[model samples]
Target chain A: MRFYGYFRSSSAYRCRIAFNLKGLAPEVVTVNLRDKAHRDDAFLAMNPQGLVPVLDTGTARLTQSLAIIEWLDETQAGARLLPDDATARAEVRAFAQIIACEVHPLQNLRVLNYIKAHHGQDQDGAGAWCRHWIAEGLAACEAIAAAQDHRGAFAFGDRPGLADICLVPQMFSADRFGLATDAYPRLRAIRAACEALPAFAEAHPARQPDAQ
Target chain B: MRFYGYFRSSSAYRCRIAFNLKGLAPEVVTVNLRDKAHRDDAFLAMNPQGLVPVLDTGTARLTQSLAIIEWLDETQAGARLLPDDATARAEVRAFAQIIACEVHPLQNLRVLNYIKAHHGQDQDGAGAWCRHWIAEGLAACEAIAAAQDHRGAFAFGDRPGLADICLVPQMFSADRFGLATDAYPRLRAIRAACEALPAFAEAHPARQPDAQ
Candidate 1:
């Protein structure tokens, strides 16, 4: 198995955490997003979306971080990334999607670039855009976590799973964008618990070999 | 089971198609999005994210359209929304997330509102923003579909599963934004095939009771 990813990408970070949690070591290939390597024809052939991290499971190349993580959970043996029950699984997935879909996309590099290029946004303007979406989305996630009937050490349960995997990366992104996360106390608590785990700590962007 | 949704929400439309495909009709409750009904305290109590398309499954209230659809696929007795093989399921989900995470969220009402309020975009500017992301995202979807080996009538296979469920509503949004479908032959063909089904046809935003 091989993983194509960039160190600082939240999506790639999510997949890295999932890989560590599942105790699988796929060979890493750094597709340098800073250099626009993701836009090259070779990378586009592998994933038309031109995004990371793409997991090549020897037979097939998978794109989209959440899909790759879910694939790992389904095929890998070490840890169960999702719950067994259907309803509980839905709740966990919903929490994850709040970050994946609602939060992350709005503040994506491409989106920021678009705003800067077309909307005349400078670094400060782009920063505000990132912070606004991150703060709002994290607030919602915190509310859901606080409202959960059986909140434990992690987002969903005692063990860190999909929700925690997604949360940790977004929290990292929040810090990168200079978004103060004090408003999301529940999310902060979950992030602290997750960061304490070696699986998450090892997957941090700063720890990756590709980190700048 | 009670489903809280608005007619025009693409997320809700995806769930409606999933429900139709699953042959499960939960009680429908319209949460009018235009009037800021989703922001009401009662609705936020149910789903703190304040998004439409919350499925109350008697057991738990589920948010995030993809999560709700997956839950329905798991618990309901009907057509399978995901393929059995792990690899195949990942491919299907990756295709769906291309729209769900990448495309839909960029054009979400809240995001558009933010851009307009902050970036000084008029109606036309917002339309351009919508068109840019929609076109780019769908081009990726089209490329993926066109490149797939053993292509069927739909996005994945003969069965219109999760990928097609997501593709159709995104096509609807594309049309709403006046983006021409001619540029995406593969996606257009998939959308044509999906729209022929009663499940997809009946779930159209115009067919819903609350559609204005």
Candidate 2:
């Protein structure tokens, strides 16, 4: 299996974290999102959406970060990213969407570019835009994390699953935008727990070969 | 089961259509987004994010429109809303996210309000904001729909699943925004197929009891 990704893409970052946690070593090929490589015909054929973090197994080429993560959870055995109970699964998924759907989409490059072109937001404005959404999302996540008594040292339980994989990167992104994760005590503590594991450490963007 | 939703909420529309097609008759409870009813404590107890389209099964309350839809797919056997094959499932999910995550998120009321408040974009500007993002996303959906050759008439294979559910609400949304769907031929054909169904026809926003 080959993971085609860019180091800075949060969706790829989540996949990298998953691979590390699962103890799977797939070959990593970097796609330069900065240089329009993702939009190329060959890459677009692999993924019509021209998005990053595509997992190419022998049989399947997958897109969408959350969906790819779901595929991994199903096909892998070492760590169940979701829980066995249906209700718990829904909670974890809802938590993941706090970042995937709410936080990340608004701060993404394309949206920022659109804002800049049409709304007259500059680079600082974009950065501010990113921080604003991430902060709002984290505040909601903090409340959700605290609500779960079953939420272990991690977001769901002692083991880091899909929610944690998604949470850490959004926090990492939050940090990038100069937003304070300090208000999210539970989230911060979980991030600390996740970072201690070599699996998560290995997948950090700073450790990725393509890191700027 | 009770579904909390609003007529024009695209996510809710997607869920309503899915519920109808799956042969489930969930009691409707409208969350008035315009009146900010979703932000109330009562609604937040069900979905902390305070978003509409929460499906309560008496056992577990579900949030995140995609997650809720997926849970419905897993718990029911009627329509098999996702593909049985893994590759096909990924494509179906990817297609769904193109609307759920990419298109609709950009045009969501909250984002539109942000544009109105912060960017000082007036009604026409706001409408343009809606049109621009919708056009880009629908164009991408058009490309994706054209790329596939399904055994059935729908986006993934012949059946109506997640992809078709997503496509229709977005098509309905585009119509609500007065955006032209003529450029997207495959998408238009798929929309026509969906509109021909009673489930979709009934789920249409205008047909809902609370529709203004």
Candidate 3:
């Protein structure tokens, strides 16, 4: 197995956490997004979407971090990324999507770049944009986590599964933007729990081989 | 089961299609998004995200269309939204996320509203914005569908599965934006096949109970 990723992409960070949890060590290849290396023909051939965290299973190449994480959960035996019951699984997935779909997309580098170019936003404006969206999403996630039967050490339960895999990276992103997270105590606690786990600790962007 | 959805919400349309495929007749409740009914305290109590297509299963509330569809696929066993194989599931999911995550978020009513309010983009600018992102995402989907092993009557194989579920609504969005679809022959063919089915036909935004 092989993985192509950049150090700071939250999507790639989610996959890294999943890989760590599943105990599958694939060969790591870094595609430097800062240098626009992902736009090269070689990488484009691997993933036409030109996104990070493309997993090459030798037989097929996988794109989309959430999809790749789900694939890993299904293929690997140990450490279930989702709960057994269908409802529980939906809860976990919805929590993850709160970050993956709602938060991360709004604050992605590409989106921020678009804002700067098209909306005439400057660096500070981009940072504020990231904060607004991230805070909105994390607030909603906090509400879900604080809901009566859902709170635990992780997003869903004791295990740091898919939601945790998604949360830790977004926390990293929130911190990068210097956003205040005091509004989401439950989310803060969840992030603290996840960071204590080696799987999440090791997946931090600064710990990656390609980090500047 | 009760589903709170607006007629024109593509996310809700995806769930409507899945419910049709699974043969589950959940009570349909309309939440008028245009009138800001989703922001009401009662509806917000059900889904804090204030998004349409919140499925109240009598025991739990579910949000996010893809997650809801997966829940339907897992809990009810009549029809398979995802393929049996893990690799195949990843392919379908990655294809779906190309729309759900990449395309839809950029063009959703909320995002377009943000563009209007913050960037001062008018209705025409918003339409152009949607067209740009939709075309980029659809082009990628077209490439994926045109891939050697992926092309068929649907997004994958001969089955109208999850990828097809996601593709059909996106096709609706594309057409609504007046974006040209001639570039994607395989996507157009797949859309034609999906539209021929009752599941897709009945799930159209125009066919909804609350459609204007």
User: Evaluated with TM-score, which candidate comes out highest?
Assistant: 1
Sorted by lDDT (best first), the order is: 1, 3, 2
True contacts kept of 3: 0.67
Per-residue lDDT for A65-149 in model 3, tens only? 9999999988886799988899989988988888887778888777888878878889998888788788888888888888847
Please, what are the lDDT tens digits per residue for candidate 3 over residues B1-212?
A: 99989888988999999999898889999999899999899988888788888988889999999999999898886788998899989988999898988888888888888878878789988898889888988888988889857446888888788998889899899999999899999999999999999988998999887889
Off by over 4 Å in 1: none
Name the runs in model 3 displaced over 4 angstroms: none
Question: Mind giving the per-residue lDDT tens digits that candidate 2 earns over B1-212?
Answer: 89999999999999988898899999999899999999999888877777888989898888888888888887875788988876778778877877777778778888888888888899889889889878988887888889876556788767788998999999888888889999999989888888899988998899999898
Candidate 2: TM-score?
0.96
Q: Which CAPRI level is candidate 1? A: high
lDDT (CA) per prediction: 0.93, 0.86, 0.88
Candidate of highest DockQ? 1
How well is each residue in A1-212 modelled by candidate 2, as lDDT tens digits? 89999999999999988887777888989999989899999998888778897889888788888888778777776777888877788878888877888889888878888899999999888888888788878888998888888747999888999899999999999988889878999999999999999988888889988888
- Please provide, for model 1 over B40-73, each residue's C-alpha lDDT reduced to its tens digit, 9 standing for 90 to 100: 9999999888998899888789999999999988
Candidate 2, residue B174: how far the Cα is off, in Å: 1.4
Clashing pairs in 3: none
Residue B17, candidate 1: C-alpha displacement in angstroms: 0.6
